[model samples]
Target: MQTLRTDVAIIGAGTAGLSAYRAAKAEGASAIIIEGGAYGTTCARVGCMPSKLLIAAAEAAHAVSLAPRFGVLPHGMEIDGKAVMARVRSERDRFVGFVVDGVHALPEADRLVGHARFIDDGLLQVGEHTRLHAKSVVIATGSTPVVPDALSGLGERLIVNDDVFAWQDLPRSVAVVGSGVIGLELGQALARLGVRVTLYGGSHGSVGPLTDPKLIDEAHRLFGEELHFETQGRVVSATRTDEGVTLRYARADGTHSESTFDYVLAAAGRRPDVANLGLANTSLELDAHGVPRFAADTLQAGTAPVFMAGDANGVFPVLHEAADEGRAAGRNAARFPHVEPVARRAPLAIVFGDPQIAMIGKHHRELTQGTFVTGAVSFEDQGRSRVMLKNHGLGHVYVDRATRRFVGAEWLGPAAEHIGHLLAWSLQMGLSVDDMLAMPFYHPVVEEGLRTALRDAASQLDRKG
Candidate 1:
């Protein structure tokens, strides 16, 4: 076998791996990145960009359909499924091209196109040929979609988020499994595009990033009114048919029903792709998620010269988080014994459904009872939302009772994506609730809704005092 030595070796050439490679190289270390799959990131190819493209098309269609409410009559509003998928695929390929080009620009000797398996803590086998003796290693192998065994029988009829962008045209019907971000976004978009959609949540109480019971209830009320979402049951059987797949769903109330759809899209979430890496051969310990045990602050795996980052670590799966972790892991791996822990940014996540959903900082479920109070504002009555004829959603901001400081927030509203960013920055900067309220809010804008929520919080604090 061909053997080589390097100061650092990074597995998987996706976001985290790429970031780690750059960081290691910047640290004056010789780093080689190994990959077994496509060069483009999950975000560029499957996760974020392409999904947003589809959502954009769905939004356009939905907006045109909603235009009649302003007393303006229109005609020729037809949604061509083939045309929609064409734009989505075309734009998606453009994004992937950019990522692949970036990879190609890197030194060819520094990139290896093969799967890497651990031979030991600092030793690895790439594909069937090369053996690498890395002084330190970073496992950034990312994650893969988790398909339940019951749906395994249907072969060609089953699809994942990756498979969606490859379609030449939108299907007539789809059965989306799971209520996570992917399921909710895809199912809602497809439904907006005039596709028959039935969303089956594996079980109730397991929706997207929102953990507060109130936000969860708001999600159920807002989304249930717009789409055919089922959270009270699970799919038990899937069988391939000539036209599509047949699904058998068992309800929580002990009843069963069957239906057929052109496709069964699995959005059940993903798992770290670390199982076959021969990690058991190493001295490193594995975590509960089956990844190597690592310090969250340093990304160091146990006491070994190994680090785990990105989706492989299962701490945070978003792109920005992956990039940050990769940077830290790579720098630390290069410096080794002199490694230092880095402070993490505040948590932030957004779901791109109609009336976008967002959460920043600690989730509602993570907060201690009576230590914090919630402030709320309903966009249904907010002036700007009403003026725009887009009045639908709720917002809640959490504040610490003792210090009256801004803590976290969950909102479902027209401009939630933007609001989430503002809140995330506030949390990261450690801004107090009074500090947020003191900021200038332009009159008659959507941001004024945020001011309203903050004012309510200030009033509550006053009452508590």
Candidate 2:
């Protein structure tokens, strides 16, 4: 067999792998990047960018439907599903093309295109031809959607988020069986686009990583009014049929019922794609999830000359987080036994559903009770929200009772994605409630809602004094 050697070897060619490759090279290390799949990021292929494209179309259609509320009387507005899918696909391909082109610019000899398996620590087998001895390795194989065995019988009728973007046209009806970010965003977008969507959430009753029971309830109430949502839904049986697929499900009460749909999307979530990497052959320890144990700050998989980054690490699957971890992993692998921990950004996550869902800094569940005070605002009557009729959600900003510092926020409202960034920055800068309240807020805008929430927090602080 042919043999190759490198100072650093990066597996997978997605965002993290590419970033790792660049960072390793920048660290003055000879690096080679490997991939066994298409040369595009998950964000470009089926994750962030493509999903947002679909959401953009859904938002446009939804906005038109709400034109009557804004005193804009319009004629008949029809949604062309084919055209919507066509634009989504075309634009998604454009984004993917950019990433692919960057991959092509890399040295051809440094790229390997075959499945890589760990024959031993620091040793990888790439197909049958190449035995690569990597001084240090970075595993950025990313993640794959998990399909529960119960839903496996649906055959071709079963799909995932990746399958959704490949559609020639949107399906007439889709039964979404997860209520996390992917499920909520895609399910709501489909519903807005006039597709029949039935979303079945897990028993936790939480949506989009928000753990505040109040926010969760508000979310269920809001989404239930807009779409067919079952907060606690479980699938017991699924099978393919001549027409479509049949499913037996259990509701919140544990009662069994049956339903049928054109397609069943197993959006339960994703797991690190490490099952086929022959990890058992390596000496590195595995975590509860069966992935290699790695340090988040340095991205090192123990003391071995190996690192883990991006979705394969199974920490935060966000794109920016992946990129950051990739850089850390690459730098650490290049430096090896002399690695240092890198400071990470403040925690932030956003769900792109209507009136979006977001959490900045620490999530609600992570905070201890009686140590923090909650300052809330309801967009039901907020100025700009009322003006635009896009105000129908709640927001809560958490402040430390002792320090009066802005700890975090969980909000569901208009401009949540933008607001999330502001809150994240506040957390990073250690801004206090008064510090945030002192920031200027315009006369009439969604940001005023944030100001109002901060003002409320300030008032609560005054009461304590």
Clashes of 2: 0
Q: Measured by TM-score, how close is model 1 to the native structure? A: 0.97
- The 10 consecutive residues of candidate 2 with the worst lDDT sum are 201-210
lDDT score of residue 120 within candidate 1: 81
In the order shown, the candidates' Cα RMSDs to the true structure are 1.3, 1.1
Instruction: Write candidate 2's Cα lDDT for 226-270 as tens digits.
Output: 898888867888878776888777887878777778999988999
Predicted structure 2: lDDT: 0.90
Tell me the whole-model lDDT of each prediction, alpha carbons only.
Answer: 0.89, 0.90
The 10 consecutive residues of candidate 1 with the worst lDDT sum are: 201-210
lDDT of 1: 0.89
Task: Tell me, by lDDT, which candidate is best.
Answer: 2
